[model samples]
Target: MSDKHSPDEKDPHDPQGMRGGLTNYGDTDFSLFLRKAFIKGAGYTDDALARPVIGITNTGSAYNPCHGNAPQLLEALKRGILLAGGLPMEFPTISIHESFSQPTSMFMRNLMSMDTEEMIRAQPMDAVVLIGGCDKTVPAQLMGAASAGIPAIQLVTGSMVTGAHRGERVGACTDCRRYWGKFRAGEVTADEIVEVNDRLVPSVGTCAVMGTASTMACVAEAMGMTMPGGASPPAVSSDRMRVAEQAGAQVVEMARRRLTIDQVL
Candidate 1:
């Protein structure tokens, strides 16, 4: 009997990239051929296709203003991936926001998680960057990436700018609650309450205060799921875009080293 493995046996440690999780066609070569052919229709060259693939999730929607910076972040991420010699592919996923979701955002968290997991499993990327903000979105992405077991990392959309109302700094539901409490106690007028609504959220992005969205961002960073200082950048700041670019560059290295999700978790 031969002691060495057969040459036909696949190398489990090989970089998956565009070759990962091919569709079942009963023929590995055919499956890969079809995938490459279709992907090439998108104008990918053989040299580019040969590079490591990095997936970035697009969770931006009009209703989810917390992720309004998705387009900018995606662009920065692509720039970083290409600079680092990797292919960046952006994919869409279900996005949930506390203010917009029917009933509650929590009700839809599991569904988003399932979507994230299945998308990662079905894609051909060697590693993925989960771009999320808001309360439930980050948790959902983490849950999904954990189950997918790929080399996955996170990039938060970041917080919003603090606005001033009546010369007082205010942002998000936290300040909204405070004002509402005062309004209920007859300390603030109905007209003033209505006027302050416009100033509460002066821009698009997550809560500026230490709400669930901000909390989850920090948790992801502290848990080693994101780069240092990944949690604090405001959504509209140049720092956030830089962080996204860094995330893209970092994920390429993670793919090269096979830094699977399990390692981080």
Candidate 2:
């Protein structure tokens, strides 16, 4: 810890030395002390923050249930990173649920990607874990990570569980559209439509379909950006949490190896 440095001795946490640009304010011992001072406000002991820093991209909000499990996922990731002798820090970027953004979610996608890339480059993490789902989040993260050139791994928030309405199996926007179509043709009553809405999304997660979110998750695995079987699981399932923890531990190894995004590509 830079907090423990003795006078007349070099501060090993210098950015050019061990911290790798994280402590780049200056090479002086007082510069290291200044960096550690404000960071201590987060209740971190010098020893904890002294370890390699792992950044977590948190793209969750109340408006986006697709990323509802982000906090749980982040906690699990932090546990594994701690066990692997690393410090995990969570930061926010723009969250884009398919139905929330105006003027088109696609229009907002490039902006989110730019936000992700800039934040990753500006932060002090040695490596990053991109946690996202929803329609645009995954690709935006990929675009950002690719440009940032940092060691990065992507984790999907997983799908929502299938719900039930009037004793029939119901999924997400797929089923939602089917029922709406019937209503539009005057074949179903307004009352039935309202009832179906309540049962469509059983839990907090992205659309439970083979749409963009799930497709990107699978693609990430195929491209070696995700762990084996990481693409398959409900967001609320224990399996998703387990995979998140594993991602955290794995990123530490990536940092140790100095595996930049170029290496993965």
- The C-alpha local distance difference test score for the whole of candidate 1 amounts to 0.90
lDDT of 1 by residue, 6-108 (tens): 2123553453766688899998777777998999999988778778899999999999889998999999999999999999999999989898999999999
lDDT of candidate 2 at residue 246, scale 0 to 100:
94
Kindly give the number of clashing pairs for every candidate. Answer: 0, 0
Clashing pairs in 2: none
Q: Which candidate gets the maximum lDDT versus the true structure?
A: 1
TM-scores for all candidates: the values are 0.93, 0.91
> Highest TM-score: which candidate?
1
lDDT per model, in order? 0.90, 0.85
RMSD for each of the candidates: 4.8, 3.0
Colliding pairs, model 1: none
